[model samples]
Target: MEKYDYEQLVICQDKESGLKAIIAIHDTTLGPALGGTRMWTYASEGAAIEDALRLAKGMTYKNAAAGLNLGGGKTVIIGDPKKDKNEAMFRAFGRYIQGLNGRYITAEDVGTTVEDMDIIHEETNYVAGISPAFGSSGNPSPVTAYGVYKGIKASAKEVFGTDILAGKKVAIQGVGSVAYTLCEYLHDEGAQLIVTDINEEAVQRAVDAFGARAVGLDEIYSVDCDIYAPCALGATLNDQTIPKLNAKIVAGAANNQLELDKHGDLLHQKGILYAPDFVINAGGVINIADELNGYNRERAMKHVDKIYDNLETVFAISKRDNIPTYIAAERMAEERIASLRNSRSTFLQNEHHVISRR
Candidate 1:
C-alpha cells in the first residue's frame, strides 16, 4: 500500500458461490473510485492482488487525465470467465461493492461482459456499462476507438503538421473489437492500413472490410508505414520493437505501451511522436462515467472527442519541458489532481472558519 500509495484493498470471498475477488482503491480525492471488474484465471492470489492494484492506479491517471470527476479503483475476480462464471458469484461480489456505500463503482472489463455487468447490477446500484435497457451505456469499445482515432490525428498534427490521414500507411497491430472499430474510422478517412492479429478470423475481417493488408505479428513492428498502432497488448514498445519501427507517430488504444519509462525517453530521443496510452484510450471510461449523470450518448461523445485537445496539451507540455510525451501526460494528470486537492482543502478550511465564527 505504501509503495503505490494505495488507499484501500478489500479481499472478498464467498465459498458457496466460489467467488474470490480483490478490490483495490487507489485514490478518491476527485470522487468515488471507478473502474472495471476483470475476471481472469490468475497464477496465484498474489498475482491477482498485484494486477488489481496496478490497474486501479492506472485508472486514477486515466480518469483524471480525461477530466472526469472520479478517482481510481479496480476489482479482480480470480477464475476463468469461460468456466467458473455463475450469477451467484457476481451477485455476491456486487454485495461487497454495495457494502462500500458508493466508494467504488465497477463496469465490464477484459474477461467480463455486459451480461456479467448486468448480473452485478442486480445487486448494487454502483455499477455502469449495463445493458441499454437499464438506461446505461452498453458497449464502450466504439467510443474508445473514436477517442483513439481523434488522438491519432492530434499526434499527426504535432509531428506531420497536418491531421489528415488520407493515403497515409498505418500499421495496426491488432484487430480486436476496439481496434476494428478504429480501423473503420481510419478507413473512412482514406488511410491505407496494414493489419495483423493472432486471430486469423479477425485479421481476415479487417482485410475484407477495409482492404487492409495482413502481416505476421512479428513483422508488424518493422512494417513501413507513416504510423504504427499497437492496439493488442501493453509493453509492445520496448527495446526490440522500438528499434524496428519505421513510423514517425506512435498512437493506439493499448495500455502501458512502453515497457519502461526509459523507453519513453528513448522514443523522445528518436524523434518519434508518441500519444500517451491512458489519455488516448480514456474514451471507454469516459463513456461509462456518463452513466453517473444519466447516460447521454451525445454528451458522452462530445466529452470523448476532447481527447484530441488533451493530447495537444500533452504535446505542448512535452515541447515546453523538452521531456517525453509519457512524462508529460503524467504531469498533466498530476497537476489536475493537485489543483483539485488544493481547492478542496481551502473549501474545508473556509467551512471550518465559518463554523468557528458561529
Candidate 2:
C-alpha cells in the first residue's frame, strides 16, 4: 500500500528504555503539524506504521475542518500502554519529538494521558494538552464528546426535521470515557441509550449511571436505534457492520469510521445521514488548539459548541454537491487548506530550525 506518501516519517528506537515508535506527518500546508501520540501494541510493525499514517492524515482533515491553522501528524509507540509506559520511555520519545523541532506537536491520544504529556514536556516545549497548572488543557475527551453530541443533533435535524434528541434511541458501540460523558448528555436530553463494550465493567457502569441497557459487543450494530455511535475504534462501519445498522443516522467521535472510502457511499445509498467522523470529533483538537495561546476552558468550550454549526455546513455542502457527507467534509477541508497554502507561501524559518520545509 502506498503509505509512503506522507510528508515525513520518523522511526525511533531507544534501546535503554526498550522504546520503539513511529511518527508520521501527513501535511503542513496550513501550518505546523499537530496531533496526539498514541501507544498501542500491534501484531507487527507494519500495522503500527499503517495506523500512524492513517491517523496522521485524519488529523489533517480534522484540523482543516475545525478551521485550525495546523496540519496533521501522529506518533505511535509500539508497546502496550498498561505495561510498557514509564518516565524514561516517554522522555526518550519526547527527545525524538524535540529533534523534529516544532514541525510536529503532540498531545495525548488512546493509551496516552496528560500525565504522560507532562513527561514528554520535560524534554520538549513542542507539546500541548499538558496540565492546567502548566497553562494547558488537561483532558480533551469531554469536549470531544460534546462535539459528537452536537453533530448527532445536526444529523437528526437533517433526517427528522428537528434537532431535538429527546426520546431518541442511541446505540453506543463503546462506553469509554468520552462515550460515558456523551451518555450523560444524551440521557439528560431524554434519549434512551444502549451501550456495549468489550470491558464488561465499563458497560455495567453505563447501565448503572445512565440506565442504559447493556448489549453484547457483536449486537451493537444491529440494535434498533435512531442513531449508532461508534466511539471505540476505527473501521467499525465496514462491510460487516453497515448492512446490519438500523439507525437512521451515524455520528460518533471515532476517527476513520469508514473502513474504506466506498463505505461512505454505501451509507449514503442506504439513506443514512452520516456526520463525518473527523469534522464531528474535532472538539478535542479545537480545545487543545486554544492551549497554544494559553488554556481557557470557557473560551475553548464556547468554540467547541460551534461544532453544531460546522456540521450544519457539512450537511449543506453534501446536499449542494450531491455527494456523501464524508466526501463533502473532505472537500471543505481541502478547500480551506488550499486557500491557506496560497496565502501562506512564504518561508519563515526559525533560528533553531524547528520548523522547516523538507
Candidate 3:
C-alpha cells in the first residue's frame, strides 16, 4: 500500500455484510480530523485508496482554510450505494469509526445520505450531518451551493472588477443538489445560465425552473460563458479540459478540482481565474462543523459566507506571490496550521475529542 504521508490509512471489513471500507486520516495538527464518508463502486482497490487519500488531504486544506480548529480525514466504502446500503453495513462501519476514538469524524458525502449518517451516529458520536432529530445539521448541499455562489461572485470581482453576476453568461456543468441551488441564486441575480447533466430529469428541472439552456455533457466545457461552474466531480480542470474552457472564471463546489498542480498553472497561464476548490467548497464542511457548536443554521451560514472574503484573500496572495491560486490557497492554509500548531500545543481533556462542545 502506498501512503502519501497521511497520518493513518485504515482498511475495514465486515465479512458478513460484505463491507470493505477505507478511512484515511491525513492530518490532525490543529485538532481531530473531520470529513465526510463516501460510498462508491470503484473499479479497483487502488482507485478507492486514491480517492480516500485525495479526499482526506482535501479536507485538511478545507478545514484549515475555513479557519476551523480541526484537521482532515475521509472515509470510503467500496460498494454500490444504491444496492449495498443497509443498517448492518453502516453500523459495522460506524464501529470502526468508534474505534478511532474521535481521531477521525465521519459524515455524509456522495453516495451517502443523512439516513446513512444517522446510522453511523448510532455507533459513534464522531458523526456529523445526521438528521435534525439528532441535533445535528442535515443536508449540507444548499449551504455548499451558497458558498459556491459567493465564490463565483468573488471570482467575478477579481476578473471583471465587479462582483455583480447580472447579465453574465454562466455555464454550470452539473445540475446536482448543489448546482441546482446555485442556479437558483444565479437566475435570481439575473445571470443567464447554461447547464448540463447526465440525468435528463435534473437537466430538465433546471431548464424549466431557471430557464437555463441545456447542453450536452461534453459541450459544457466549450460553452462560451463568463464563468464555468463544475459541480459534478473533481479533476475536471485537467489538461484535456483546460484547453477547451472559454470562461474567464472557474469556480464550483467540487473538491480537488485540479487534476494536478500543473493544471492550475495551465489555468493561470490561460488567464482563467480559478477559485481553489477547498476554499470555495468549504461550505459543506463548515455547515456540518456547526453541529459541534449546537447546530445553529444562521451561525453556520455566516461562516460559509466568509468564503467570499477568504477567496479574495487567496487571490491577493496569488497576485502578490505570483503563484497559482491553488498554490496560494495551500500556502494560506499551511501558514495558518503552522502558526496555530506552534501557539496551541496542549491536548484537549475530553476522551472523545469533541471539537466544539457547547
Q: Please list all clashing residue pairs in model 3, or write none if there are none.
A: none
Q: What is the number of residue pairs that collide in model 2?
A: 0
Per-prediction TM-score to the true structure, in the order listed: 0.97, 0.94, 0.95
| True-vs-predicted CA distance for residue 296, candidate 2, Å | 1.3
Per-residue accuracy of model 3 over 281-337 as CA lDDT, tens digit each: 999999999888799999999999999999999999999989999999999999998
Q: What tens-digit string does per-residue lDDT give for candidate 2 at 11-83?
A: 9999999899999999988889999999999999999998999999999999999988899999999999999
lDDT of 1 by residue, 41-150 (tens): 99999999998998899999999999999999999999999999999999999999999999999999888999999999999999999999999999899999999999
Worst 10 residues of 3 by lDDT: 344-353
> Number of clashes in model 1?
0
**What C-alpha lDDT values do all the predictions have?**
0.95, 0.91, 0.92
TM-score of candidate 1 to 2 decimals: 0.97
lDDT of 1 at 356: 100
